[model samples]
Target: MLSLHANVYAHPEGAATGPRRELRGLPLPTLVGPGGGPPPFLQVLPVTFEQMQAALAELPRCDCEPDGFFLLTGHTPEGVFWRLNGHMQEYQPEDADGPSMHRIELNGECPVASLDAVLRTIGWPKAQLAFELVREGVTLIEADFREYASQPATEGEPRRPDRGASRVPAPCRGRDDAALGTSALEANASYTPWHITFGTYGTRLHGDRRPTVDLEHNEYGTPYLPRNELRRRRAEDTLTGPPVHLSAEQRRLIERLLPEICHRGGWRIHTAAAQSDHVHVICDVRSEVHGEKVRRLIKRWLSEALNEKWPDPNRLRWWAVQGSNKAIKDESYLQNAIAYVEKQRTASR
Candidate 1:
C-alpha cells in the first residue's frame, strides 16, 4: 500500500486544494526521501541569466508575482521531475550582467536536498532543462504569452533556444481547451510527444468507444458512443482472433524489458505497468516518429521479447489495433496517469 502522507509539493495541478501552501516562510521536514536522505542543506550552482529570466518570467505572465518563491522541481529529459529538498529564497539580480553567475539560497535556516543526486537519478546531461517552475499548482508555461524580452546573445549562444531544443515546451493552449482539460497533444505540450496506440486483436471491445482515460467525466471530458460497437465488430471480424491474455511471467518480463526498450530508443519510461490483455507505459519519447510508428515499434519489441521467452508462432496479433496515447502536458495530468496505471496494478495483485 502507498503511504498516507500529505504531499509537501504541488499535486501537479501546480496548486493546493484550498490553501495556498508556501514553503518560503515555513520550516521544512527533517528527512527527504526514503531512508536517511540528504539533510536539507544549502547547495549552490551556476545558472545563465537568460536562462533564469526565461524561467522566472513565467511568474508575471501567469499573473503570479515575483516573490522569488516556488517549487523548482528538476525534470529529467526523461520527462519526470523530483522536488528539491528545500525552498529557494530571494536573491537580488547582479547590478552588472554576465553569464552563468547566480545561485539563490534560502535563509541560513532551511537546508536543501542535493540537486546533483537528483540529476544523477534522471541522467539528463543539462541541469537547466530539468527546471520545471511550478507555483500554486500551476506551471509557468501557461503565462508564456510572448517571448522573453529580447536579450543580447551571450557567449555566442542564441538569445532563445533553437528549434527542437530540449527545453520545457510552453503551453500553447486556449482557455477554452484548458477549461476542457484537453489532452496535451491538443493543448499543453512538451517537446516529448507520446503517441499511445491500443490494438484491438487481443482485448475486449465496446460497441461504442469513448474517449476517456477512466470515467466518463475525465480531465479531457472525452465522450464515447452509447451503443455496443465491440459486439458488432466481433460478429463481422474475419481476420483477427480473440484478445490475447499475457501470463504472469509474460507480464513481468514485459514490465522489466519494456523500460529498457524505451531507454534504448531515447525515450524515458516514467510509469509502466501491464495486465493480462494490455500494457500501459507513460514515457517521454525522444523520437520524432509518428505515434503509430511508436506504437508499432513497441509492439514489435514486446512480440520479440514474448516470443523469445514463450515462442508461439501461431499467435499473430498481440495488442488491439487502436489505443489511446495521452500527451502528458501538465503535472496534474502526469500524476493522474501514474495513479491510474499503478492503482490497477495494485488492485490486480
Candidate 2:
C-alpha cells in the first residue's frame, strides 16, 4: 500500500538517464503493473531522489489526534490486538493477489503508550516507529499500509488527521486536544531534516563555489562560488591569522575529537568530517537547538583542541566568520549530505 495516499511524483528524464534503473549507482524501484511478470526493466524511471523529496515535502500534516486508523507490519501478536482493546484486522499487502507484506489494520481511538506497553508486554521490539511513505501510481509503491495526509477543514469539510503514522496512536476518546501527539504523528509524514554542510574560513570566499551549499543548504550538484570575489572577501574580513588551513593531521585530529565535543554540547554526531579549510558535521539535536549555537560550540571546542595540541602562545581563530545553517526539509537531503561528507574523506585520502 502507498504510505501516503497522494499519487507518487515522478520526473520523467532528469535522474533516469543511466543505462540501468539506477541513479548515481543506486538501484531504483522496479516499475511493474498488475500483470507483474519480470517486474519491468530497471531502465524505466521509478521515483527519482528529487521526486521523493518533493513527495515528502507534500506529506499530510497531523492537525489533531491521529485516531481513526493505523497499520502494523507483521501479524500483530494476538495479545497486542487484545491489549489495544480496539479493532485489529490482519492482512497481507498483495500484487496480482500475491501477498507481499504482513500487516495489521488498527481502528478506533488508541494511545501510543498503549501500543508501546503491549509491544513490550508481548516481547516485541519497542520504539522503531517511523512513518512509512511509498511512491505509487506510475511507480508502484511498496509499504505496509495505505495512508495520506488530510487537507485542512473547510467550512463544511472534515479534517482527517494522519493516523498514528507508525505506532504513535493518540487519544480520541473524549478530547479534541490539538496537541495530542501531533508531533509524533507527523514524525515521518513530513520530516524536517536538520542535516547541513557548511564551509569553513577561506573555503568559500565568493558566491557560486563548487561543493558549497546554497542559501537553502542544498549540497547536491556542483558547488558555485565566484572566483573573482576571493580577494575582496579577504580584504573586508578581519585577519584571523591568515585563514586557518587545517593540515591533514589537524583535520584527522578534529574528526577524532569532534564527537566528544558534540556530546559535551548536548548534540549527537551522525556524520562528520574535517577538511583543509572547512568542516562538515551532521548531528542530532533538539528542534529548538540553534545552528549558530552548535557552530559556536564547535568553534570553541576546536580552537581549544588545536591550542592544546599545537601549543600556540597566541590563541588563533580556526573557523570562518560565516557559514550555512538551514533547516533540511528533504529526507534524501540528509542521505545526500552524508554521502557528500563521506566522499570528501575518501578523496582527501
lDDT of 2 by residue, 1-349 (tens): 1112221111112222212232123344433322432222112112222332333233222111122122222212342221111111111222323211112222222234343332332122421222112222223222212112222212322233232222112321212223212322333332233454445555555443353443444333434544556655654473434555678888888888877876665565677887787888887655654555466457656865786688542223456554566566576877888788877762358
On residues 1-349, what C-alpha lDDT tens digit does candidate 1 reach at each position?
0001011211122221222222233222222222322111221234433444345444311111122222223334555433322222222233424323122321111112233322222222332221222221111111120111011112332222222222111111101111222222323333454535353353545553533232232223355435566654763474334458777777778778877777555555676777776677777753343344355557656865775577443454465544566566678777777778776452257
| Global Cα lDDT for candidate 2 | 0.41
On the 0 to 100 scale, the lDDT of residue 138 in model 2 is 24
**Candidate 2, residue 11: lDDT:** 18
Worst 10 residues of 1 by lDDT: 1-10
Residue 282, candidate 2: how far off, in angstroms? Answer: 0.7
Q: How well does candidate 1 score on lDDT at residue 315?
A: 51
TM-score list, all predictions? 0.39, 0.39
